[model samples]
Target: MGALPDGVYHIKLDDQQFLTIGEEGAVTVLPAQDVGQKFEVRRASGDNYAISKPSSIWPSPFVCYDGAPAAPYEGTRVRLRVSDFPPCEWKITAGSRPGTFTIVVAGDGQPLTIGIAPIPIFPPFLQLTSSSGKDLGWTFEEAK
Candidate 1:
């Protein structure tokens, strides 16, 4: 399986909208923009990653404070744990091609497939600034 390195990625949904994390901990598919458009995917343990906004203290994987079913079922809206240490964590299983991945969530060790796709279209957003740190622009590059 291809491992997703930790960083903010620009992911698009099947509906052509982007996955956005609101400052109030609301996750939604909204139009792309700088605000709430970036997501920080951080490594937790092994191949699991914690998805959250750079400024937020909670991670997306925490959406399972109560246990999850042994298998993923559609129409479930799991709630976040409200803590940094995820009550549940996620693993991105590789899909048939690049940029495609399936989400799996686990709580206290038992992992279960969520069977959802958050199609990542590019790598981290690179900020290009002058020596004085003035704002310039952004660029997309290969993950190191």
Candidate 2:
């Protein structure tokens, strides 16, 4: 860690590392600790970005195309439309059969991480029906 200037940084750790600030405002490393500890980088005004356990797990709000059974499948694709501040499009696909997926979006100086969990498979044939600014539609099919 070095002089982090009050913004979100994608940090890479050798193991578990503790971050400390020196007297002169320089960032110093303490020691390696927990395997899955999270931290936040913030300003004095309590404005900050935090790294923590995800509050909920679901498909992306911007995702357009999703196929189901909610289980992993090959040739599955997800389309994302970003028409607001960050104007762009993203298409995520599983090469051959679904499992767990992680997608990172980084462009135009902004970054976001999207996580897709393993499909349950209780119901089958999941499909995307509709979408709005921050809303999305999904339907499921019963197994045959």
Query: lDDT of all predictions, in order shown?
Result: 0.47, 0.25
What are the clashing pairs of model 2? 68-126, 69-124, 69-125, 69-126, 73-97, 73-98, 74-97, 124-141
Residue 86 local lDDT, model 1: 49
lDDT string, candidate 1, 28-109, tens digits: 5555676766655678778777755455433333434233434433334433345546455566665434455655563344
TM-score of candidate 2 to 2 decimals: 0.19
In model 2, the Cα lDDT at residue 135 comes to 18
Query: Candidate 1, which ten residues in sequence have the lowest lDDT sum?
Result: 126-135
| Backbone clash pairs in model 1 (N, Cα, C under 3 Å; residues 3+ apart or in different chains), count | 0
Candidates in order: C-alpha RMSD to true structure: 12.8, 19.5
Q: Which pairs of residues have clashing backbones in candidate 1?
A: none
Model 1 earns a TM-score of 0.56
Model 2 Cα displacement at 48 (Å)? 8.5
How much is 66 displaced in model 1, in angstroms? 6.9
Q: What is the lDDT of residue 81 in candidate 2?
A: 27
